[model samples]
Target: MEKKVIGRRERITLPEWGLKMVTAKVDTGAYTSSIHCTYTEEREVDGVMTLFYRVLSPDNKKYKDKIIATSNYTQKKVKNSFGQAEVRYKVSTKVIMFEEEFDAEFTLTDRSKMRNAILIGRKMIQGKFLVDVAEVNLSLKSKK
Candidate 1:
Protein backbone atom coordinates (compact mmCIF):
# COMPACT_ATOMS: atom_id res chain seq x y z
CA MET A 1 0.00 0.00 0.00
CA GLU A 2 1.19 3.53 -0.69
CA LYS A 3 1.25 6.22 1.96
CA LYS A 4 -1.04 9.17 1.45
CA VAL A 5 0.59 12.58 1.22
CA ILE A 6 -0.88 15.48 3.14
CA GLY A 7 -0.96 19.15 2.21
CA ARG A 8 0.31 22.29 3.95
CA ARG A 9 -2.81 23.50 5.68
CA GLU A 10 -5.33 20.78 6.51
CA ARG A 11 -8.44 20.45 8.61
CA ILE A 12 -7.88 18.13 11.54
CA THR A 13 -10.13 16.64 14.16
CA LEU A 14 -8.85 16.24 17.71
CA PRO A 15 -11.49 13.94 19.09
CA GLU A 16 -9.68 13.46 22.36
CA TRP A 17 -9.71 17.19 22.87
CA GLY A 18 -13.23 17.70 21.53
CA LEU A 19 -11.96 19.74 18.61
CA LYS A 20 -14.11 19.00 15.60
CA MET A 21 -12.44 21.03 12.90
CA VAL A 22 -9.20 22.92 13.43
CA THR A 23 -7.14 24.78 10.87
CA ALA A 24 -3.43 24.26 11.33
CA LYS A 25 -0.60 26.20 9.81
CA VAL A 26 1.96 23.86 8.40
CA ASP A 27 5.29 25.44 9.21
CA THR A 28 8.48 23.79 8.05
CA GLY A 29 10.54 26.40 9.86
CA ALA A 30 9.45 25.19 13.29
CA TYR A 31 11.24 22.19 14.71
CA THR A 32 8.31 21.15 16.88
CA SER A 33 4.61 21.69 16.45
CA SER A 34 2.55 23.63 19.01
CA ILE A 35 -1.05 23.90 20.14
CA HIS A 36 -2.89 26.68 21.93
CA CYS A 37 -3.69 25.68 25.48
CA THR A 38 -5.01 27.29 28.62
CA TYR A 39 -5.24 26.29 32.30
CA THR A 40 -2.32 23.96 32.15
CA GLU A 41 -1.40 22.02 35.26
CA GLU A 42 1.39 19.65 36.16
CA ARG A 43 0.52 16.87 38.55
CA GLU A 44 2.14 13.76 39.99
CA VAL A 45 0.65 10.32 39.83
CA ASP A 46 2.41 7.41 41.55
CA GLY A 47 5.61 9.47 41.57
CA VAL A 48 5.29 10.10 37.83
CA MET A 49 4.72 13.63 36.72
CA THR A 50 1.87 14.13 34.26
CA LEU A 51 0.36 17.11 32.51
CA PHE A 52 -3.24 18.13 31.93
CA TYR A 53 -4.30 20.94 29.68
CA ARG A 54 -7.20 22.41 27.76
CA VAL A 55 -6.86 23.46 24.13
CA LEU A 56 -8.33 26.78 23.15
CA SER A 57 -9.76 26.94 19.67
CA PRO A 58 -9.89 29.90 17.32
CA ASP A 59 -13.53 30.43 18.18
CA ASN A 60 -12.44 31.97 21.49
CA LYS A 61 -14.21 29.18 23.40
CA LYS A 62 -12.22 27.09 25.84
CA TYR A 63 -12.36 23.39 25.12
CA LYS A 64 -12.81 22.42 28.75
CA ASP A 65 -12.23 18.86 27.66
CA LYS A 66 -8.87 18.12 29.25
CA ILE A 67 -6.26 15.86 27.79
CA ILE A 68 -3.95 14.00 30.12
CA ALA A 69 -0.55 13.54 28.57
CA THR A 70 2.89 12.65 29.81
CA SER A 71 5.82 14.96 29.45
CA ASN A 72 8.20 13.77 26.77
CA TYR A 73 10.85 16.33 27.69
CA THR A 74 11.52 19.98 28.28
CA GLN A 75 13.08 22.52 25.94
CA LYS A 76 15.00 25.57 27.09
CA LYS A 77 15.60 28.99 25.67
CA VAL A 78 13.37 28.53 22.64
CA LYS A 79 13.57 31.64 20.55
CA ASN A 80 10.26 33.07 19.42
CA SER A 81 9.48 35.29 16.45
CA PHE A 82 10.27 38.38 18.51
CA GLY A 83 13.66 36.93 19.48
CA GLN A 84 12.49 36.22 23.02
CA ALA A 85 13.74 33.01 24.58
CA GLU A 86 11.28 30.96 26.62
CA VAL A 87 11.15 27.48 28.04
CA ARG A 88 8.27 25.22 26.95
CA TYR A 89 6.93 21.79 27.72
CA LYS A 90 6.76 19.13 25.03
CA VAL A 91 4.21 16.33 24.79
CA SER A 92 3.37 13.55 22.37
CA THR A 93 0.03 12.82 20.73
CA LYS A 94 -1.53 11.26 17.69
CA VAL A 95 -2.55 13.74 15.03
CA ILE A 96 -4.85 12.85 12.16
CA MET A 97 -4.13 14.51 8.87
CA PHE A 98 -5.89 13.63 5.64
CA GLU A 99 -7.49 10.70 7.47
CA GLU A 100 -4.08 9.34 8.40
CA GLU A 101 -2.91 9.31 12.02
CA PHE A 102 0.63 9.56 13.30
CA ASP A 103 2.40 10.13 16.57
CA ALA A 104 3.87 13.61 16.83
CA GLU A 105 5.44 15.85 19.43
CA PHE A 106 3.83 19.12 20.29
CA THR A 107 4.93 21.98 22.50
CA LEU A 108 2.32 23.29 24.87
CA THR A 109 1.86 27.07 24.99
CA ASP A 110 -0.73 29.79 25.26
CA ARG A 111 -1.14 30.68 21.59
CA SER A 112 -4.26 32.79 22.10
CA LYS A 113 -2.29 35.74 20.81
CA MET A 114 -1.56 33.89 17.60
CA ARG A 115 -3.96 33.49 14.74
CA ASN A 116 -4.28 29.70 14.74
CA ALA A 117 -4.42 27.36 17.72
CA ILE A 118 -2.62 24.43 16.14
CA LEU A 119 0.65 24.68 14.21
CA ILE A 120 1.85 21.64 12.30
CA GLY A 121 5.62 21.88 12.09
CA ARG A 122 8.28 20.19 10.01
CA LYS A 123 8.92 17.44 12.52
CA MET A 124 5.36 16.20 12.13
CA ILE A 125 5.15 16.77 8.38
CA GLN A 126 8.43 15.17 7.38
CA GLY A 127 7.87 12.50 4.72
CA LYS A 128 4.16 13.05 5.08
CA PHE A 129 3.35 16.36 3.47
CA LEU A 130 4.31 19.14 1.07
CA VAL A 131 3.46 22.72 1.81
CA ASP A 132 1.91 25.15 -0.63
CA VAL A 133 2.11 28.62 0.87
CA ALA A 134 -0.53 30.06 -1.41
CA GLU A 135 -3.01 27.32 -0.58
CA VAL A 136 -4.85 26.73 2.67
CA ASN A 137 -6.84 23.64 3.66
CA LEU A 138 -6.21 22.11 0.28
CA SER A 139 -6.45 18.63 1.74
CA LEU A 140 -9.61 18.57 3.85
CA LYS A 141 -12.35 21.07 4.39
CA SER A 142 -13.15 22.17 7.93
CA LYS A 143 -16.53 21.04 9.28
CA LYS A 144 -16.79 24.13 11.44
Candidate 2:
Protein backbone atom coordinates (compact mmCIF):
# COMPACT_ATOMS: atom_id res chain seq x y z
CA MET A 1 0.00 0.00 0.00
CA GLU A 2 1.92 2.96 -1.23
CA LYS A 3 0.33 6.31 -0.54
CA LYS A 4 -0.36 8.67 -3.43
CA VAL A 5 1.37 12.02 -3.17
CA ILE A 6 -1.17 14.77 -3.87
CA GLY A 7 -0.54 18.46 -3.90
CA ARG A 8 -2.24 21.29 -2.06
CA ARG A 9 -4.64 21.35 -4.97
CA GLU A 10 -5.74 18.48 -7.18
CA ARG A 11 -8.07 17.72 -10.02
CA ILE A 12 -11.07 15.73 -8.93
CA THR A 13 -14.20 14.40 -10.58
CA LEU A 14 -17.70 13.17 -9.80
CA PRO A 15 -18.54 10.62 -12.45
CA GLU A 16 -22.03 10.07 -11.08
CA TRP A 17 -22.75 13.73 -11.58
CA GLY A 18 -20.87 13.95 -14.84
CA LEU A 19 -18.60 16.57 -13.38
CA LYS A 20 -14.92 16.24 -14.25
CA MET A 21 -11.61 18.01 -14.11
CA VAL A 22 -12.63 20.20 -11.22
CA THR A 23 -10.13 21.78 -8.87
CA ALA A 24 -10.29 21.03 -5.18
CA LYS A 25 -8.30 22.46 -2.32
CA VAL A 26 -6.84 19.94 0.07
CA ASP A 27 -7.26 20.80 3.72
CA THR A 28 -6.03 18.84 6.71
CA GLY A 29 -7.82 21.03 9.22
CA ALA A 30 -11.30 19.99 8.19
CA TYR A 31 -12.81 16.61 9.00
CA THR A 32 -15.46 16.16 6.30
CA SER A 33 -15.16 16.80 2.60
CA SER A 34 -17.47 19.51 1.17
CA ILE A 35 -18.62 20.47 -2.30
CA HIS A 36 -19.92 23.76 -3.62
CA CYS A 37 -23.60 23.69 -4.35
CA THR A 38 -25.25 26.46 -6.23
CA TYR A 39 -28.64 25.59 -4.87
CA THR A 40 -30.02 23.29 -2.17
CA GLU A 41 -33.45 22.53 -0.83
CA GLU A 42 -35.27 20.06 1.34
CA ARG A 43 -38.02 18.31 -0.55
CA GLU A 44 -40.24 15.24 -0.47
CA VAL A 45 -39.92 12.80 -3.33
CA ASP A 46 -42.66 10.15 -3.61
CA GLY A 47 -43.26 10.36 0.14
CA VAL A 48 -39.57 10.01 0.88
CA MET A 49 -37.78 12.97 2.39
CA THR A 50 -35.04 14.07 0.08
CA LEU A 51 -32.61 16.84 -0.58
CA PHE A 52 -32.42 18.57 -3.95
CA TYR A 53 -29.10 20.10 -4.84
CA ARG A 54 -27.07 21.24 -7.80
CA VAL A 55 -23.29 21.42 -8.07
CA LEU A 56 -21.02 23.72 -10.06
CA SER A 57 -22.62 27.06 -10.67
CA PRO A 58 -24.08 27.90 -14.03
CA ASP A 59 -21.21 30.30 -14.58
CA ASN A 60 -18.67 27.49 -14.57
CA LYS A 61 -17.54 26.07 -17.88
CA LYS A 62 -18.34 22.48 -16.93
CA TYR A 63 -21.74 23.30 -15.61
CA LYS A 64 -24.30 21.09 -17.35
CA ASP A 65 -27.49 22.17 -15.58
CA LYS A 66 -27.59 19.14 -13.38
CA ILE A 67 -29.88 18.65 -10.41
CA ILE A 68 -29.24 15.84 -7.93
CA ALA A 69 -31.48 14.57 -5.21
CA THR A 70 -30.95 12.06 -2.43
CA SER A 71 -33.03 10.46 0.24
CA ASN A 72 -29.88 9.03 1.77
CA TYR A 73 -28.68 12.18 3.41
CA THR A 74 -28.36 13.94 6.74
CA GLN A 75 -27.89 17.32 8.32
CA LYS A 76 -24.87 18.43 10.30
CA LYS A 77 -23.63 21.59 11.91
CA VAL A 78 -20.03 22.47 11.12
CA LYS A 79 -17.88 25.41 12.09
CA ASN A 80 -16.69 27.33 9.08
CA SER A 81 -13.40 29.18 8.64
CA PHE A 82 -14.73 32.21 10.45
CA GLY A 83 -15.80 29.98 13.33
CA GLN A 84 -19.42 30.41 12.42
CA ALA A 85 -21.46 27.29 12.91
CA GLU A 86 -23.81 26.53 10.05
CA VAL A 87 -26.06 23.65 9.14
CA ARG A 88 -25.24 21.80 5.94
CA TYR A 89 -26.55 18.83 4.03
CA LYS A 90 -24.40 15.73 3.80
CA VAL A 91 -24.78 13.34 0.89
CA SER A 92 -22.94 10.34 -0.49
CA THR A 93 -21.57 10.01 -4.00
CA LYS A 94 -18.76 8.36 -5.91
CA VAL A 95 -15.60 10.42 -6.12
CA ILE A 96 -12.58 10.00 -8.36
CA MET A 97 -9.23 10.91 -6.91
CA PHE A 98 -5.83 10.14 -8.33
CA GLU A 99 -7.29 7.57 -10.73
CA GLU A 100 -8.98 5.66 -7.92
CA GLU A 101 -12.71 5.76 -7.38
CA PHE A 102 -14.68 5.25 -4.19
CA ASP A 103 -17.84 6.28 -2.42
CA ALA A 104 -17.35 9.49 -0.46
CA GLU A 105 -19.55 11.69 1.68
CA PHE A 106 -19.72 15.38 0.95
CA THR A 107 -21.36 18.23 2.78
CA LEU A 108 -23.25 20.51 0.48
CA THR A 109 -23.30 24.28 0.95
CA ASP A 110 -23.10 27.55 -0.87
CA ARG A 111 -19.50 28.09 -1.92
CA SER A 112 -20.15 30.82 -4.45
CA LYS A 113 -17.86 33.10 -2.49
CA MET A 114 -14.96 30.67 -2.39
CA ARG A 115 -12.29 30.57 -5.06
CA ASN A 116 -12.46 26.81 -5.43
CA ALA A 117 -15.80 25.00 -5.48
CA ILE A 118 -14.54 21.80 -3.85
CA LEU A 119 -12.69 21.37 -0.57
CA ILE A 120 -11.15 17.99 0.15
CA GLY A 121 -10.98 17.48 3.89
CA ARG A 122 -8.70 15.37 6.04
CA LYS A 123 -10.99 12.36 6.22
CA MET A 124 -11.15 12.04 2.43
CA ILE A 125 -7.39 11.62 2.08
CA GLN A 126 -6.31 10.47 5.52
CA GLY A 127 -4.69 7.14 4.73
CA LYS A 128 -4.64 7.15 0.96
CA PHE A 129 -2.86 10.39 0.20
CA LEU A 130 0.07 12.52 1.28
CA VAL A 131 -0.17 16.22 0.52
CA ASP A 132 2.83 18.37 -0.38
CA VAL A 133 2.35 22.02 0.52
CA ALA A 134 4.65 23.25 -2.23
CA GLU A 135 2.97 21.32 -5.00
CA VAL A 136 -0.17 21.61 -7.06
CA ASN A 137 -1.67 19.24 -9.63
CA LEU A 138 1.07 16.62 -9.19
CA SER A 139 -1.47 13.94 -9.96
CA LEU A 140 -2.68 15.80 -13.01
CA LYS A 141 0.63 15.35 -14.78
CA SER A 142 0.47 11.61 -14.25
CA LYS A 143 -3.18 11.44 -15.33
CA LYS A 144 -3.79 9.66 -12.08
Candidate 3:
Protein backbone atom coordinates (compact mmCIF):
# COMPACT_ATOMS: atom_id res chain seq x y z
CA MET A 1 0.00 0.00 0.00
CA GLU A 2 1.18 3.50 -0.82
CA LYS A 3 1.70 5.80 2.13
CA LYS A 4 -0.50 8.90 2.06
CA VAL A 5 1.16 12.07 3.25
CA ILE A 6 -0.92 14.69 5.06
CA GLY A 7 -0.24 18.01 6.72
CA ARG A 8 -0.70 19.30 10.25
CA ARG A 9 -4.30 20.15 9.47
CA GLU A 10 -6.66 18.53 6.98
CA ARG A 11 -10.21 18.81 5.83
CA ILE A 12 -12.10 15.53 6.33
CA THR A 13 -15.66 14.52 5.72
CA LEU A 14 -18.12 12.18 7.33
CA PRO A 15 -20.15 11.30 4.27
CA GLU A 16 -22.34 8.79 6.06
CA TRP A 17 -23.58 11.57 8.31
CA GLY A 18 -23.97 14.10 5.48
CA LEU A 19 -21.06 16.20 6.70
CA LYS A 20 -18.63 17.75 4.25
CA MET A 21 -15.39 19.70 4.35
CA VAL A 22 -15.13 19.44 8.10
CA THR A 23 -11.87 20.82 9.47
CA ALA A 24 -9.81 18.44 11.56
CA LYS A 25 -6.53 18.96 13.36
CA VAL A 26 -4.00 16.15 13.30
CA ASP A 27 -2.57 15.49 16.75
CA THR A 28 0.15 12.94 17.28
CA GLY A 29 0.09 13.44 21.03
CA ALA A 30 -3.46 12.23 21.46
CA TYR A 31 -4.12 8.53 21.69
CA THR A 32 -7.53 8.74 20.00
CA SER A 33 -9.29 11.20 17.74
CA SER A 34 -12.32 13.20 18.84
CA ILE A 35 -15.12 15.31 17.40
CA HIS A 36 -16.60 18.45 18.89
CA CYS A 37 -20.12 17.73 20.08
CA THR A 38 -22.80 19.52 22.06
CA TYR A 39 -26.38 19.22 23.25
CA THR A 40 -26.07 15.50 23.76
CA GLU A 41 -29.32 13.74 24.59
CA GLU A 42 -29.81 10.17 25.59
CA ARG A 43 -33.13 8.40 25.20
CA GLU A 44 -34.45 4.87 25.09
CA VAL A 45 -35.46 4.19 21.55
CA ASP A 46 -37.29 0.89 21.25
CA GLY A 47 -35.84 -0.40 24.52
CA VAL A 48 -32.29 0.44 23.48
CA MET A 49 -30.30 3.39 24.74
CA THR A 50 -29.55 5.79 21.93
CA LEU A 51 -27.55 9.00 21.79
CA PHE A 52 -28.31 12.14 19.80
CA TYR A 53 -25.79 14.94 19.41
CA ARG A 54 -24.63 17.72 17.11
CA VAL A 55 -21.14 18.13 15.69
CA LEU A 56 -19.54 21.57 15.81
CA SER A 57 -21.27 24.72 16.87
CA PRO A 58 -24.03 26.24 14.75
CA ASP A 59 -22.02 29.45 14.39
CA ASN A 60 -19.39 27.65 12.36
CA LYS A 61 -19.72 28.14 8.61
CA LYS A 62 -19.57 24.39 7.90
CA TYR A 63 -21.84 23.60 10.80
CA LYS A 64 -25.08 21.83 9.97
CA ASP A 65 -26.72 21.74 13.39
CA LYS A 66 -27.52 18.18 12.49
CA ILE A 67 -28.86 15.86 15.13
CA ILE A 68 -26.95 12.64 14.58
CA ALA A 69 -28.00 9.42 16.29
CA THR A 70 -26.09 6.33 17.31
CA SER A 71 -27.36 3.16 18.93
CA ASN A 72 -24.01 1.38 19.23
CA TYR A 73 -21.84 3.66 21.31
CA THR A 74 -19.95 3.78 24.59
CA GLN A 75 -19.14 6.19 27.37
CA LYS A 76 -15.51 6.16 28.41
CA LYS A 77 -13.36 8.27 30.68
CA VAL A 78 -10.77 10.28 28.81
CA LYS A 79 -8.33 12.97 29.85
CA ASN A 80 -8.98 16.39 28.36
CA SER A 81 -6.61 19.16 27.26
CA PHE A 82 -6.51 20.41 30.84
CA GLY A 83 -5.43 16.96 31.98
CA GLN A 84 -8.74 16.40 33.71
CA ALA A 85 -10.45 13.07 33.13
CA GLU A 86 -14.04 13.17 31.96
CA VAL A 87 -16.52 10.73 30.52
CA ARG A 88 -17.30 11.13 26.84
CA TYR A 89 -19.33 9.31 24.26
CA LYS A 90 -17.44 7.16 21.80
CA VAL A 91 -18.85 6.40 18.35
CA SER A 92 -17.55 4.56 15.33
CA THR A 93 -17.83 6.18 11.94
CA LYS A 94 -16.30 6.26 8.48
CA VAL A 95 -13.86 9.09 7.87
CA ILE A 96 -12.60 10.25 4.49
CA MET A 97 -8.83 10.40 4.44
CA PHE A 98 -6.75 11.01 1.31
CA GLU A 99 -10.08 10.64 -0.48
CA GLU A 100 -10.34 7.06 0.80
CA GLU A 101 -12.72 5.73 3.44
CA PHE A 102 -11.66 4.11 6.70
CA ASP A 103 -13.26 3.05 9.97
CA ALA A 104 -12.47 5.39 12.86
CA GLU A 105 -13.50 5.62 16.49
CA PHE A 106 -14.21 9.16 17.74
CA THR A 107 -14.91 10.42 21.22
CA LEU A 108 -17.47 13.20 21.42
CA THR A 109 -16.86 16.20 23.64
CA ASP A 110 -17.74 19.87 23.92
CA ARG A 111 -14.92 21.58 22.07
CA SER A 112 -16.71 24.86 21.54
CA LYS A 113 -13.65 26.74 22.72
CA MET A 114 -11.20 24.82 20.57
CA ARG A 115 -9.93 26.17 17.30
CA ASN A 116 -10.73 23.04 15.30
CA ALA A 117 -14.02 21.22 15.14
CA ILE A 118 -12.45 17.79 14.91
CA LEU A 119 -9.16 16.29 16.04
CA ILE A 120 -7.35 13.38 14.35
CA GLY A 121 -5.23 11.61 16.93
CA ARG A 122 -2.23 9.30 16.71
CA LYS A 123 -4.29 6.13 16.30
CA MET A 124 -5.84 7.48 13.10
CA ILE A 125 -2.52 8.64 11.70
CA GLN A 126 -0.36 5.63 12.62
CA GLY A 127 1.42 4.20 9.56
CA LYS A 128 -1.29 5.69 7.34
CA PHE A 129 0.07 9.18 6.80
CA LEU A 130 3.29 11.16 6.98
CA VAL A 131 3.07 14.60 8.51
CA ASP A 132 4.78 17.63 7.04
CA VAL A 133 5.14 20.40 9.59
CA ALA A 134 5.22 23.08 6.91
CA GLU A 135 2.06 21.92 5.14
CA VAL A 136 -1.66 22.05 5.75
CA ASN A 137 -4.80 21.05 3.89
CA LEU A 138 -3.07 18.33 1.88
CA SER A 139 -6.26 16.29 1.71
CA LEU A 140 -8.16 19.21 0.15
CA LYS A 141 -5.39 19.68 -2.38
CA SER A 142 -5.50 16.00 -3.31
CA LYS A 143 -9.24 16.16 -3.90
CA LYS A 144 -8.80 18.67 -6.66
| Clash tally, candidates in order | 0, 2, 0
- RMSD of candidate 2 to true structure, Å: 1.4
Best by TM-score: 2
Task: Give candidate 3 regions above 4 Å deviation.
Answer: 61-64
- In order, the Cα lDDT scores of the candidates are 0.71, 0.87, 0.87
Over 1-144, each residue of candidate 1 has an lDDT whose tens digit, in order, gives 454455556787766556666888887888788888775678887888777666674355455555556655555456665678788777777777777777887787888788777888888877777676777776564323
Q: Candidate 2 on 16-125: residue-level lDDT in tens?
A: 88888789999889899999888888888789998888987778765657888789999989998779999999998898887899888899888888988899999889
Please, what are the lDDT tens digits per residue for candidate 3 over residues 1-144? 768889989988898777887779988889889998877889999999999988778776555567889898999899999999999999989988777899898999988889987999988888788888689999878867
Residue pairs clashing, model 2: 98-144, 99-144
The ten-residue window of minimal lDDT in model 1 covers 57-66
Cα error, residue 61 of model 1, in Å, equals 4.2
Which 10 successive residues of model 3 have the least lDDT summed? 57-66
- Go through the candidates in order and give the C-alpha RMSD of each one to the true structure: 3.3, 1.4, 1.5
- The TM-scores, one per candidate, come to 0.80, 0.94, 0.92
Off by over 4 Å in 1: 1-8, 57-62, 65-77, 141-144
